[model samples]
Target: MRVQFSIALAHLLRRRRSTLVSLLGISLGVAFFLAVSALMRGSERDFLKRLVDNSPHITVLDQYRSARVQPAELRWPDAAVAISNVKPPVETRGIRSHRSKLESIEGWPGLRVAPVLRGSAVLTFAGQQQGVSLSGIVPARMKDVSTIDEQMVAGTLDDLAAAPNGLVIGQGLAEKFQLGLDSTVSMVTASGGARVMKVVGIFRTGNAAYDEGETFTLLKRAQVILARPNRVNRFIIQLADPQQARTVAAGIEQAIGYKSVSWIEASEDLLSLLLVRNIIMYSVVTAILVVAAFGIYNTISTIVVDKRRDIAILKAMGFSATDIRHIFLYQGAVIGLLGSCAGLMLGYGMMHVLASVELKPPGVSDVVHLPVWWGAEQYLLAIAFAMAACLCAAYLPANKAGKLQPVDTLRGAI
Candidate 1:
């Protein structure tokens, strides 16, 4: 068996170019597939981590039917009444709150609740007007939800100067208005066109959507401008442990007597996008691998016919058909093994090259770094698939050699 294997190996080496090409095709496909899969997973994980780290774990909103509300019109539920409503709430609804009820959630177990006043409005300065969504936050409360104050690119939210009338703008918004720190702009309320605000500081949130359209003002000032005087939209909450988010969220809903939602629950659209991307990616890679497998089949089939005469000679020398088949299969295995190894190395090298290149959209951050995930599992999977394809590729050719008639083969008849 060992001698037969050596003879088979010699044949493959003599036709090294064809074997190499076949191996190269399969190896390249595996490498590309692995690289793409790693990149997609890495990007998703990074984005999720950043989002969770920088944003509140939970948020409490009034679950209102309309945009604005007045405390006089709505009675604030007390703590006892709020807690008694303990139960799971519906999705897509914000948690309900009044100033007293919202403020009451501050000391809840494993939770930090912060009242927020939010609304959409238009900013007008130097005859340049842009529409933006304004969030009224207590700087102290902002700390509980995010470390965004530290991410400020050009100005500080301190321009609110601890004053009720102070305001901050996102970096993208700042560029649009050509505004800087201490640069003031008038914010016109979209609600009944009732108010205006002065932009005191500009802040960059590092999120394109938020940075371009988001602005912040002190909670008290926001109330005054929007004419709500003493009410807020919702209480943004941060949990002590992220793993307990659902539990904490349920508690908030019951404690606040209103519907509540966690980030994972609210981010269904983003989740859908990720799922679609994964499906598309896997489907494309699978197709490429299938095509590469066919190449293996073609190469193996051609080599089988070329070696039929040799097979007949071996059979006449007393080699069994099974032994003949094993020789050709071994040749295919060698090709598969070498091809897969080379592909993995080259693929990883390409990924390293990609890592050094900075990628970003125009007028966006200077660089967007992507992460790469490589492991033994990926390599194993690639090699396993390649070998399986190679084995299948060799079967037909080997069978043909095994069934060859020695008499006709020796007479130079195919």
Candidate 2:
């Protein structure tokens, strides 16, 4: 077997140019496959981490509200006219009874719920007006549902108590307003009333939507401004395992006898967007692999034709047809192994290049760098797939060589 392998190696080496071309094709395909899979996996992981870190795995809200947009304060001012345009309601209920249920929810296995009051308002600093989303939370309770404690860039929510009419703003918002922790900003409610708030803290979420629009204050204060006393917009639920978000969401809904949803379910459109991107990438990679497989088939067919005389001589010497087939099959396997190794290195190199560059989505300035995941499964899958393609490519030519009549092969014209 060793001798046969040695001969097969020499045969492949003899046609170095063709071997190199075929190997390059295979390597390119495998590299693309590896890189894309790594990118997708990394993006998914990063997105999930951000979701769980800044927000919650599950967010329980009233059945009447759509999860995509912020809660409304009231029925549209012109219900019939607004229904014609399908605008989100201006007013959303924030009943305190919903928050009162958190105690029972916290007792459930693998579940933690935090009450939050979120509403829209306008803030004026230095005569400049900016719209903001006001979010109210108990400092300790907020920590139970998110990484708010870690995201504080300056000051503390604890100071909110000392400074009545105090609020913690996002870094992005502060920068936009040119305000600081001690700055006083007057917020105008949707109802045209105004309240002055002392900026007690600033935070950065690295997400524009949140960091640009969110302002945190005591629930009692926010409720007074929004004119919804003792009511909350939503209950953020944290789970032990985010993977179990859907299951726990169902349990929470069952317990509350109301509609509820996980972050994944709430953000179906976002998930769908990711899914579409991945599908497109996978399709492109698959096409490249198919072309590489065809190249392998052509290379093996050429090899068969080139070695016709040798095959005839071996057969004449009583080498079985099965032995002839194994010789070529083994050659294909070696080609696959070498090409796959080269491909892995190529893929890793490309990932390194991507890591150095800053990439951001449109309408956002934050750079979301790509992440690399070097998984055992990715390596093993590349090798197995490449080998399988090569073996399949070799079969037709190898079988044809094995079936040739020795005399016919030997007497063949040039």
Best by TM-score: 2
Model 2 C-alpha lDDT per residue in residues 1-414, reported as the tens digit of each score? 775677678888998888888899889988988888787777776776776667688887755333443223254554453323456656657544774577778888876777888889999888789898888887777877778768898987777767768899888889988988789988998866589888999988777678888888987888788888778878888888888888888887877755677877877898898889878977777677768877777887898888899988988988889888888887788878888889999988887776676888898666767876667777777777788888888788889878877898778754
Question: Which ranges in model 2 have alpha carbons more than 4 Å from their true place?
Answer: 1-7, 64-92, 190-194, 313-321, 358-368, 410-414
Candidate 1 — number of clashing residue pairs?
2
For model 1, the stretches where C-alpha displacement exceeds 4 angstroms are 1-8, 38-58, 64-113, 121-131, 158-161, 175-178, 184-200, 206-209, 227-230, 237-257, 262-265, 306-327, 359-381, 398-414
Model 1 weakest 10-residue run by lDDT: 64-73
RMSD, one per candidate, in order: 7.8, 6.5
Number of clashes found in candidate 2: 8
Q: Pick by lDDT: which candidate is best?
A: 2
